[model samples]
Target chain A: MKLFSVEKPGLYTTYQDLGRVGYLKYGVPASGALDRFALQVGNILVGNERGAAGLEVTMQGPELLAEETFVMAVTGGDLSPMINGRRIPLWKSVLIKKGQVLEFGQPRQGVRAYLTVSGGFHAKKYMGSRSVYEPAGLGRKLEKGDELVGEPRQQKAGTGLFFTEIPDYDRDVDVRVVKGPHHEQISDKVVSDFFAMTHDVSPQSNRMGYRLQSDLATNHEANVISDGVPLGGIQLPGNGQPIILLADRQTTGGYTRIGTVIGPDLPLVAQLPPGGKIRFKEVSVEEAQEAAKQEEQKLRIWERFTR
Target chain B: MKITFYPLGEAAVKCCFHEDISTALTYNIQAFCKKLVHQKHVGISEWVPAYDSVAVYYDPWKLSYEEITNVLVPIANEMDAHEKKTKTVITIPTVYGSDYGPDLENLAAANKLSTKKVINLHTKRHYLINMIGFLPGFPYLSGLDERIAMPRLESPRQSVPAGSVGIAESQTGIYPLDSPGGWNIIGRTPLKLFDAEKEEPFLFEQGDYLQFTAISEDEYKQIQREIEKGTYKLERREESE
Candidate 1:
């Protein structure tokens, strides 16, 4: 069913899901929602599967015209979404009739937002995913006049997330990290200096990785033989700057990775806007796992209540 | 063949094979990956093989880091116990020199040899796919002849078309997609290295061998037509270890 038509394609809007799997060996990166937690919450609000394909809106949001009555929800980064000139609440499901126009204003919080429809966005799946990985020519950004479609799913009653469930994206975020494979290669003094410094998110940041700008300089030789790079791995190149690999990072890289951002803290890292300040804190692997367990538990609880 | 397990993060582990880069090491890693895949451990999502290590990614919620390490240790220890599998070599039909390879003349001039000599050197040896990375379906091939090896372009081309065969610093590779590259272009392949629509999206895999065969420009056009007609059959052969 035709759900909406793109009137104005906002800044870098693309369809995304949980991303492709089992193809990393072929040099494919797992391209998906940068903020996976927000996308899942949007899916839940609209009564769709957690991994449903949805629009990943950047700082700016697209202006869409509804083609039919459907339930939709916008979550993650407050880009100020509105329908028919009236503002809509984030993390809540709302129904829109045909001929209604949905648009967005200034981004008050967060760097990315997700717009999910009831049956999820019906985008072409490449290698079992609708995620748009532009470099590979898998999919391109949504453009003006593009018609958006969704599977015909029965509309459930509208719902909203509890106040406590909604994440606060407009705040100082301290991302936690675990020592990577080559963590021991660097000197202890350099490592301690790195943790003590605050970094600014470089403007060169994108889906591939976030390049951080810091004043700390080290003469450490950071180049290693190209090896497997994990998502959220913090790589230090020759310049002594750190690049945090993200959802679209290459399968292997030649730089030395100092540490990997814990899985639970990735969403917070993803939400950090350009020029945003970030601090890094080191934690043990066991502690990171415990945090992941708590996050999973919260999702499971939300899954039951949303169902 | 000692393999050490390290935590990449909560969701993945890096199995480091403390060995130098060699065809033997690649085969051993391939053998271990083959055995690991057969286990089909739940929550083990994906694994990538590199020059000297294999990174195993799994869902931490379903499987613990220790549980995955336990599953990987035995397989790494017994990897050599299994017999070596047959190797498959895929032939890539390429057109060397002329407009197809714009930098062929410049590369020949830099190496103090004719374009024909460079082409012969490139096609003589079977290159090994050490890994697939940098771009989707882009193979990091090894075994370039040192005689013709040259440095990458100081300023990379804004857009190197897909199927461009190039050489850089004792390494040769083909760009699977139209991407900005710095390698010295010497030839072009008509074959699509990656087609997302197909069941097997990538034509090459890590540990596989590739042989480039020179073809005339007319033959290239014919092969491309056959590919568009869905009638082109890739030339491949299986060699016993």
Candidate 2:
């Protein structure tokens, strides 16, 4: 059934899920929600499956008019979401009536947010996924006058998350990293300098990867044989700048990567807007794995309790 | 066939041969990938086979990094002993020169060869597929004839049409999708390199061999129509190696 009509297609809004997998070997990127935790929480709040398709709103949120009454939850970077000119709470499921308009104001916290309805958005699936990867034309961003289709439910039992469960996007984040495959190839001085300096998220950052700038400079010939690149792998090009490969990063690259940001800290890094401050701390492989396990445990616990 | 294991991240590990790029190394990597698929290790999600390495992605919740590396070491030891299997070489019908390949004349001049000679050199060899990357179904084929090999454009074109064949350095490939590319285009193919609607979306796979046969523009249009009507039969033959 028709759920919402797009009055305004906010800055680069697109439907996304967990991501497209098993096609990286064929050069297909695993384009998915950058902040996976937010998308998962949004889906769960609206009583939808964890991996259900949802609207991934960017810095500005779209003005969507509700065609039918349904339940929705907005999670991730707070863009000051509102309904019918009245402010709505973030990280909580809310009921919307027919003809009610939902929009967003200034980005008070993170730059991205996920809006998931009870039945999830019914975007056309390409290659076993609904995630919109604009480059290869697999899918596209939402445009004005587009009608969003979904499975509307009558139940309006809304849910709200605890204060401790929410993440603070306004502050500078320290992300944990594990040594990458080519870590040994980098000089000890360069590696130490990387950890010592504070990096700023470059304006050229996008879903493909985030280009970070720091004061440290080295004429390091960091080029290596082209090889498979992992998500969150920190690629150090010849200019000695770091590029954090994200959800839409290519499957393989030629540059040498020093370290990879742990999975648990990926969402935090994803939320950082342009000019946001970040620091990286090295951790053992075991420690990184343990952090991932703890994060997974939180998700499992939430899944058991909610719906 | 010694391989070293390192953590790509918490969930993925890089199994590197630490060897230079060679056909033998490519085969060993392909063979190891095949063995990996057969094992069906728990928590392993997907793997990407590149020049001299295979990156194995797994679920940290299901298995730890250390546990996965232990499973991979045994597979590496047995990979070299596997016999080489017969392969299939897929032939691509291409239309050379004119608007289909805008850079053909320029490349021919740079190499001090006639446009016809360049075409002949490009089609003479059956190139081995090193990897499929950069763009979906974009095969990084090796064995480009040195006579026709050229560097990429200084500034990449904003949009190179899909199936546009190009050469860069010692490598040659066909763009599976319309994307910004710097390679020197010399021909075009009507066959879709990538079709998301199909059961197997990608036309080429890693380890498969590719052969290019020059075709007339009219034949290109005919093949395009057949492909659109779902009547085109992909030409395939047993590897002559």
Candidate 3:
């Protein structure tokens, strides 16, 4: 039903899912929800598929007016969701009636938030995903006066869905990383300095990458043969600044990549605000695998609990 | 080609080949990529083959890095034992110089050659699709004539139109989409390299061979119209080899 009409599109709101997979060879970026954990939780709360497309509100959120009855859940950065001027709790399903306005106030924590409804947001699936990848012209950011359709009701009203452990958006973040394929190409001093320094997220950081700034001057030539760049790649351009590739990163890059953030810890970088401080810690591949396994187990338990 | 496997994050593994960019390395990369896809490895999500490396993104839940590396080693080594596959040859019609090619005169002057000679040198050799990156459907081509090798612009244009045939250093390629690039454009093609709405989405695949056939501006417009109407089909044939 075309019930959810966007009254005020927030700062950079778009529809995203679990990314468009299996198209990297064509240079397509796996555009998906930056905070996958939050998106899964939000979807599960509303009894939707894990890969279902949902609105990813960044910093600010849209003022949506519902013209029908539906169940919705807000996850990720607590963007202060409210219904009809009354604040609503996050991490749990809430009911919305006809003519009710769903609005968000200033973000209380984190940079991105996910709003998933019963029956996923209906969007044109391009290359196996409903994610809005502006580069490919698949879909674009949410604009005012846009009518969004959702699936017919497949879920009943839900309640009492809450996580015991909420992600702390204000905590000092240590982004765990595995050494990149070309880590040896850089000087040992540069590597040491990189780990020792506390980097601040640059203002220009986006879904493509997080450009970090540090006072340390890393004077090294970072000219490597162009090669495949994986998600979370910490590439150090010739300018000594480090850019950590993220969800919308290019398929390949030529700068020297020193390390890649571990999979489980990617959400920490994703949730970090523009002025957030981050320190990199190098860990073994085995450690990264263990962390990912633990995260999966936690999500599985959460999924079961919500069900 | 000697291959070495390295862990990339928790779910991906990167296979590094030779450090140099050569046709042999590209072929080895392609052979392994083809074998990997044909074998239908269970957990492999995607394989991105660039200048000298292939980064395989996989599902950690279904497969581990060690298991993936173990399966990849033998497949990479036994690539030659498998039957050699034929490549798809694609002809890209291009309009060189004038408005179609804003930098053709400067490129000719930089190479100490006439515009006609530059066009001949570019069209004489077939280009190998070494890698696909930078932008969606943008092919990184090789086999450019070193004599006409031109450096990239000091500062790249804010935006270059799609289908622009450009050269940078010793490599030549076409901008599949309107993106910011530093390559020196010498011509424009009439083909739409990327259409996200299409079922296939991409016109050319990695390892496909491309031959540029120069055409007049009028012909370029005609082909463009046909492409818009879905009447123009990109000419393709199986390589004799």
Candidate 4:
């Protein structure tokens, strides 16, 4: 059986799939990979279906020992990767020797990273996912002496291809959004300032949501009823700062929502790390849908390549 | 009439139980939610039950917003009749005061009442769990004796241990998980409020009746050990009107 054993985990790390759906009623947050784009790319490189469980490493990754599988590719968040004391290239598939020690160093760029094996790693699927939500203390994160078993694919099967560098890779990005239903409730200025201005990602950020510093000169807090909020919903609490909801955000909220991040640019927002600067550009629903269509087409084209 | 739908985007639809928040309306809305949850209507993924409003989320591809509201309004009307029907009173066994109640002295002093009198007043009123929020199974209860109504602690504690029984702004609840919270911790319950491992994670849900009993600290330790060992058998007493 092919597997990789964990050596050391750097910061916060977990085995995340796309997310846990159909369980929000139970108050369970859809815990999963923060950056779906990187996870999807990594899964595709390994010939596994997109949304497969992969190691979502924070800043740096853990040292692992491969049991049998040779080819593995890592994408998103540049980090120093070493294979058995020899430097290994990232954003491309590498030939890992049997019993080789693969270690990761500090991130050269971005906050989170993804590590994918030829076959996907195996963990207990909760509800319908294998993701580990630390807040609820579910599933497992890699630690020293821990083994990650995978459903190894045959070597002769998929092509062991590699890439030189990741495209569209960056630390921060300007997010595009569609206005919300409560958009009219808030001051015209809060909406204008949020759209026309730039904001910085606060250090107090996590998988649940990103706390963003507002560009508004003055502050106005409102006592809004807690209501349901979506993944990309931008909620400006009593404080002026806009807290952009993310993949693992609460199922509901009461704060005044500025807008949603739409579909296409969601990936770009996901790749951002704390302390990264980002701006918002408002777009109509039609524009958001068109962008989504383009992304869906891109996925379909890529699926035809190695299949 | 223009119904406010898609307020939170295509994910959810907002149906006002009433413009004003009322306990009676809360019951009516809760009844509506209970029926909806039972039906498991197509595309409706999760239904978050609250005091005066119910935020219903659905799969956009399954049904459009307008279509959902059509089905929601009619089904919600059934709640008015259902509320008048037979209602179940769920009594929750709570151990009040002592180490089980760490802030008992403080709570008593703040209310200018003896700890024994405070216990009697608290147990006398039948509480209604308006909703569950903040954390998993942290029930938001109403019906506190007006004599005991007090504001939350001036400074919210950074960490309140799990099973912490706290009161804040006329609401009482037990902390389901150990996390940073601002609730005025009056006491702690040895009973597990939430257990992800259990089939029913939340010990209490909306509309459940709560009656706290005074248990000694010695009994508190026994319950804690039982909870840890997974042998905590909670006693459910016969319902009394």
Candidate that scores best on DockQ: 2
Model 1: share of true interface contacts reproduced: 0.76
What digit string (tens of lDDT, one per residue) describes model 2 on residues B1-241? 8988889879899999987888888888888888887888789989999999999999999998779988888888886754776777999999999999999999999999999999999888998898888888889898889989899999999999999999999889999988889999999999999998788887778888999999999999999999999999999898645
Q: For this target, which candidate reaches the highest TM-score against the unseen true structure?
A: 2
Model 3 CA deviation exceeding 4 Å by range:
A305-307, B80-86
Report the TM-score of candidate 2, chain A only: 0.98
lDDT accuracy of residue A4 in candidate 3 = 91
Error of 2 at A195 (Å): 0.5
lDDT of 2 by residue, A159-217 (tens): 98888989988548899999877877778888899998889999999999999987456
| Candidate 3 C-alpha lDDT tens digits along A146-204 | 99898746556555344566777764588898997877888888899999888999889
Q: What is candidate 4's local distance difference test score?
A: 0.71
Model 1 over residues A1-307: C-alpha lDDT tens digits?
8999999999999999988999999998899999999998888888778998999999989999999988899999999999999999999999888999999999999989999998899899999999999988889999999999987566764698888878888446788998878877777877898898888888899999999987556666787878889988999886878999999999899988889999888888888888887889999887888888898888778878877
Q: Model 4 over residues A1-307: C-alpha lDDT tens digits?
A: 5478777876777898888875564466777787776787777777778878999888767888888756677777777778888767656666677888888887777777788877777877776788897666677667788778777665533343335325464666877787875677788887788887778888888788888886565355555666556777888776687887877787667677878886556667666777777888877655655565565566556656644
Q: Chain B, candidate 3: TM?
A: 0.94
Which DockQ values do the candidates obtain, in the order shown? Answer: 0.81, 0.87, 0.81, 0.28
DockQ of 4: 0.28
Which residue runs does candidate 1 get wrong by more than 4 Å?
none
Q: Model 3, range B82-164, lDDT digits (tens) per residue?
A: 25467678999999998889999999998899999999999998889999988899898888899999999999999999999
Report the error of model 2 at residue B68, Å: 0.5
